[model samples]
Target: MEQKLKLWFTEHQTEDYGITFRVNHVYESEQTEFQRLEMVETDEFGTMLLLDGMVMTTDRDEFVYHEMVAHVPLFTHPNPKSVLVVGGGDGGVIREVLKHPSVEKAVLVEIDGKVIEYSKKYLPNIAGGLDDARVEVIVGDGFMHIAEAVNEYDVIMVDSTEPVGPAVNLFTKGFYSGISKALKEDGIFVAQSDNPWFTPELIRDVQRDVKEIFPITKLYIANVPTYPSGLWTFTIGSKKHDPLAVAPERFHEIETKYYTPELHTAAFALPKFVKDLTI
Candidate 1:
């Protein structure tokens, strides 16, 4: 007999940023403690899994999201020897960061250990990079970890989920302050800010929060198929250098899929609609 596929939509709406938000219910044949999971998907973007049946990422595309999130900030730094990744249990972010030869250590702080285990089992392509010896996986609260982290890292990447649930603190001023304190004086920080098309308030709020703490704050955009809208935004906070100021020659040795030296320069060139929000 053929197995049955059971999935139903619970709620769907269009947010202010032009991205579609969705919540779904999934049913499985076996009886499990966690039977249903929330699946978020965007019309122009990719899908994401929240729990058991929750589909966090999508098939249409995910490379752009992973690549841009990791490479942009690492490449911005003159030499990044150590890196920290908060909430990227899937390992895609770590994979990209390890590409840099200068990196000596990569720490992954994931709140849920199951997310990492499940991703490794189900999504090999995305989770494969965590196996690298240089990576140190710490299963705990990122906020607490950052708060206690003695100034050791050169780059910190906040690859967290939306500003809801446990992820709420990751977007607050307090977290940014903790991130600022966790880094070296000249360290660089970047995060996966929500899609500007779907969450303008979030983008505006994060930009405001980071600007208050960092000497240089900038917002950039990328096209990820699994997110709400096809468009996504990443906010970069620098302690002493401008990301856009990376010399063209320095990027030649780096291998990239979505971000080129030209694209890196262009990503910061936000459209007027987005540019208006930062001010």
Candidate 2:
């Protein structure tokens, strides 16, 4: 029998349980000024990016998270010409934003520049849109960007990491208020609220905070396998538009791998447990 190497990269999603991916190769690992960044090629999920030992995204299933975050609010607004993306250094959100012809300018603010640099080299397909002519990449703090912005963007997407380290402020009530001020009168915003299975309190707290800020607040979900528990939640806050009330004429056929016109409204149909969190 030929000798075989048994190497696996495991993410301790929680203290009790974890997910392990068989490792084919480990490309780069380092501790940036912000967090631990690692790039690995896995036997299962293809190229994998881990931030602070947590699975961020994999080549196999990035479309679901990126599409849901970018499209739902974009479609809800009548015209989203100016958009801001906070902490999506991987550029997946920016890629989806550019898909809409109505977007004239897309601004990306990432506090950690290392995430963008590595993603551009290791995950080009997802990060390529950061270099697009319409995209203006800013390397700085996203929280301050939200505070300084005054009725500037038509849409804002918070593509942040889990609530830890640099992302802690992204989930606070003050940030949500700043987001409301940052948006135009009819603008909308969306933020990944994490998986309900592991963090039900997070979902509940985020929903409560967002509801206090935006006139239209809704919680939706998407199945992202790499994320903890594979059930990810997103909280959408809108000033003058409701995602559930979008007309068919408002939706145009766009090139997408996961999101569709039919699935748009269907995503908002939450289960009883998740629905209770919104209460």
Candidate 3:
């Protein structure tokens, strides 16, 4: 008898190249009003989540993304009492937010309610904070939510997907302006600006747009294995705070896997080519 060739789960990250993983099992797959959601068990990544055929996060490497997204902006601000998250339905960002004692409340606005339901069930470790008392889960449009808010939140995280479907507006200058209006005078914000390797223009546009709206703007990098190109970029904008000037004492302590006090300042040190995009 001959051994069989195991099937693989592949994501076409771009027209030229794609990534694949050995699929142990597919927990579930379904299409919601917004996008396709999938939970799968993989040999390399253990439990993995996918949205619209894109690799959202995997159990093993999720720490890199969640920690970077949360800590950079949270640490940038001296005190972040109230925080709002846009499109982070998986609850990973919320979990990181609750680690800060200064965060009195974390409001998560996800358009697809099913993403929250399934994430809580399938990705428990990542989504555990959704049930926390300090987290407010709202099923609605993040764009509209940002528009209605006025000087409310101290820190805002835009954990959105690629510029498609519901996330297209999130990458626009108008939406960045809305975030400025929604935040308090000293508020800070960080958004995943896609990968510099493939989407350098997008990163450039986001940095330019954010610079126009916020007094302080900077770009940082994080390596996420599951995301496109492995090298991911985050753009941080602040009304009054500068992530570079954060004092050594400002970073007290936090339980994080990928982020640290030293890395906080180092992440902003971008490669020459990636830095050229911002210039």
Candidate 4:
């Protein structure tokens, strides 16, 4: 007799609700100094990365998140030469950031070396840009890096997890203040602000904090199926440029599956309910 067993991985997004995926195989499962890291093969998502029992990135829909997070601000800035990416160990944001010809140097500061090490092995397509000559990977505390750097980056991207564990400080007002000092006078920065459905307060609080620091601040949305609520929000804070007012000439041809020239402004068109959170 031959018997088959089905394995499933469930991310308990909240105490009451969560999402589950049918697992075909488990590639890597271990606890690093920071968090629990797991790489699993799923029928729907190809390969899935989980940190602390939450979806981080997947093979199928990563482009949507990575592209929106990178392009929205890159296009907003007139000429971003040096950029800093804090907490995106998967290298997905870095991959998208390099698409712009204006970016000459991209530094990635991630706290966990394990996330970077295993992502390269299990998620090559997403992590490919980490090895590029323009990228300098630093396996250290991103919070401290921002505290030390002064007027260093033309653009900064905070591709971090939800406000938990190591990422808690990233969402604080003090960090936003540090980011203001870390950026060039006219630098632009964007951060994944989690979904408005589960964390409306987070969205509201981020908006309020960022608005105090940057003259131009906006909220944008993207649909990433594997993420919580299937709806994700990113908060952009800029000293000079405005993402919505990007000129037509600023947009150039780029290879992307999700982000487009038209969608750059369109993504900021939030639903009524989601828009309420930003106010």
Q: CA lDDT, every prediction?
A: 0.77, 0.94, 0.92, 0.95
Give the local distance difference test score of model 3: 0.92
**Candidate 2 regions off by >4 Å?**
1-5
Model 2 pairs whose backbones collide: none
Q: In candidate 1, what are the lDDT values of residues 53-90, reduced to their tens digit?
A: 32346434666887888888888888899999998888
Candidate 4 yields a Cα-based lDDT of: 0.95
Model 4 TM-score on a 0 to 1 scale: 0.98
Per-residue C-alpha lDDT of model 2 across residues 134-238, encoded as one tens digit per residue: 999999999999999999999999999999999999999999999999999999999999988889999999999999999899999999998999999999999
Instruction: For model 3, state the Cα shift of residue 104 in Å.
Output: 0.5
Q: Which stretches of candidate 4 lie over 4 Å from their true place?
A: 1-5
Poorest 10 consecutive residues by lDDT, candidate 2: 2-11
